[model samples]
Target: MAGEMAAGLAEEGGSKIKMIVSYVDNLPNGSEEGLFYALDLGGTNFRVLRVQLAGKEKRVVKRESREVSIPPHLMSSNSSELFGFIASALTKFVADEGHNALFNDRQRELGFTFSFPVRQTSITSGTLIKWTKAFSIDDAVGEDVVAELQTAMEKQGLDMRVSALINDTVGTLAAGSYYDEDVVVGVILGTGSNAAYLEKASAIPKLEGDIPKSGKMIFEKLISGMYLGEIVRRVLLKITLQSSIFGNIDKTKLRTHFILRTPDISAMHHDGTPDLRIVAEKLADNLKITDTSLETRKMVVEICDIVTRRSARLAAAGIVGILRKIGRGNPGDKHKSVVAIDGGLYEHYTEFRQCLESTLTELLGEEASKSVTVKLTNDGSGLGAALIAAAHSQY
Candidate 1:
């Protein structure tokens, strides 16, 4: 994986792992002060945030945020409709906050956290390379995402400038670095999995022209919340077709793609009842498989465990891969390398988080693992975007 990442960084195309440039040369220095906004659009939900910073002394003095779920239709809708819905949500959030949230008369600046593959043109603009995690807006592909949002904002009479455009992993890295300067890698394991890390500008071979002082690279992963449930569903479906463990059960719900969510699996996996009641409950509730035997419930839990463990182990390997790429995985490296992780999978799924952390430690070995730390930054991407906006503010 480490070698693949290097190859991806050097190659312009055809690499399974795309080490895309983030165009974020600078992270927040913790001295940025003022009011800033952040819009995080990733997966089925989007979030808007406003933050008031008081420079180095106080950090974030005030903050407000709102989360809006995108309708299923919007995920497959045209670019205009999706952006319009997002922009309308942002306008409402701004109006609800009123002028009191403003630090001064300066125009509102926003940092956009777009968690998708993008070919960045600059720090403030990037064209969508493609959509992931269920989004498939055909017209939006190859279009400048920042411009799309900007146009939508204009149509809604919202006055704001997008100062920074970044991936969620980049934002999480920025957020982590704000408090701990040692943080170098950021990983997101929620709806979709991806990682971003700061790399020496000179190391990227595909980069053209003069190299900046710093560079960041992002890559995607398949083992994440968005696909975990579907994986479990497929496994169960295969088992049902091959055996009679389910005993003539209606496979209608099981046949449905994405019918079982990560949360449902997490709940079932964490069931501690003597009878594995939660497992049976989830099977009944989500897959409509009721009156499950204790043995069958155990099998279901085992499946969840197997799937979750695989994902966590793979995620651990990914982190180690990044660490190795950056020359920080060796036992001789005494520097404290902190990996900032965010997303619902890492934050809310206790078992997944534990398995990931433990697997990471195991992969690093006891001696080398002592110098590494994985910190959870809940909603760090959103706050980091706001901070980046402040850092790049036109004041």
Candidate 2:
């Protein structure tokens, strides 16, 4: 068996397995201070926060929130439109809370928490390689996200500096580390999902550098909230064709749309059987057309169940992979392998969460599993952003 991952998150004693390591970890050190703001732009909504920092002693003494819905057209709309909307909303937040000393006598600084994947170059700079999770902002791909936000802020006439452009996972790690130095990894299981962990530079085969104690790593966002509905869609189309669900339907119209969100998946999971296809048809019926055929519903539910099942399993695998990469495996290692989990899918999807934890247990056995703790830490993105603002606060 491969080396036990995350103490008990991976299997042990199966057979000897070969492993190769790659990727660099650049997790930031958790010491600094300043009042700061954080803006989270993820699916459906954008959240803005104003946090007052009190440093390590008083830490994140103040916080506020506002949610902005993306107009239906903007989701499938252009990049300029997407970022522009975010810019405008941020402008409004800044203007509404005018003249806060969070700026520390200079322009205000912020930590932008983005959930999408990026090829990060620095804490504050990264190139958006591609947009997934239902985002098709083609123009924004290959551009520096921090710079984009900077440009947008300038356009909005908001005097702000982006000190950090972090993915939600990194923010979670930072948040975790800020509280407990032992927290090495952070995982988000909301509608969509991803993970981040502290890594040693020497452990990374892909990069050449001395391992910085402050450096850590973030994982891929292959399976997260934004992508689950699409996953269900891909699996359901085949079932729909054979099951007569769309026999009376317009394929052309059905061909172009998003039918499910993570909430639907959560609902199906609670339905006992957790059938995906049934959930899909149920979802389609709710959003698209009238329902009749039993076979159609069955086909949809079963397909949905299968896709959801597979996604959970794969997510566990990715976690296994990360824990392995971080040297957290090995039975009875006794290390406190804390995986701080957040997000909608993991939090709301009971069956999915069970399956993931079950898979991890199977992979990592009793003794090692004892050392592994999976915890639900809600909305660290906002609080963590506040924490960063506090840590970097100049006031």
Scored by lDDT, the top model is 1
Go through the candidates in order and give each one's C-alpha lDDT: 0.86, 0.64
- Flag regions of model 2 displaced more than 4 Å: 1-33, 43-45, 69-92, 95-107, 115-119, 128-143, 151-159, 208-257, 260-262, 272-304, 386-395
Q: Give the Å error, residue 99, model 1.
A: 6.8
Q: Write the per-residue lDDT of candidate 1 for residues 255-322, one digit (tens) a residue.
A: 99999988889999889999998888888888988888898899888899998888888899999999
Model 1 alpha-carbon drift over 4 Å, by segment: 43-45, 68-106, 129-139, 151-159, 209-222
User: Tens-digit lDDT track for model 2 on 201-278?
Assistant: 443343432212211222223366666666676555655677665656655434555666666655654554433355
Steric clash count of candidate 1: 0
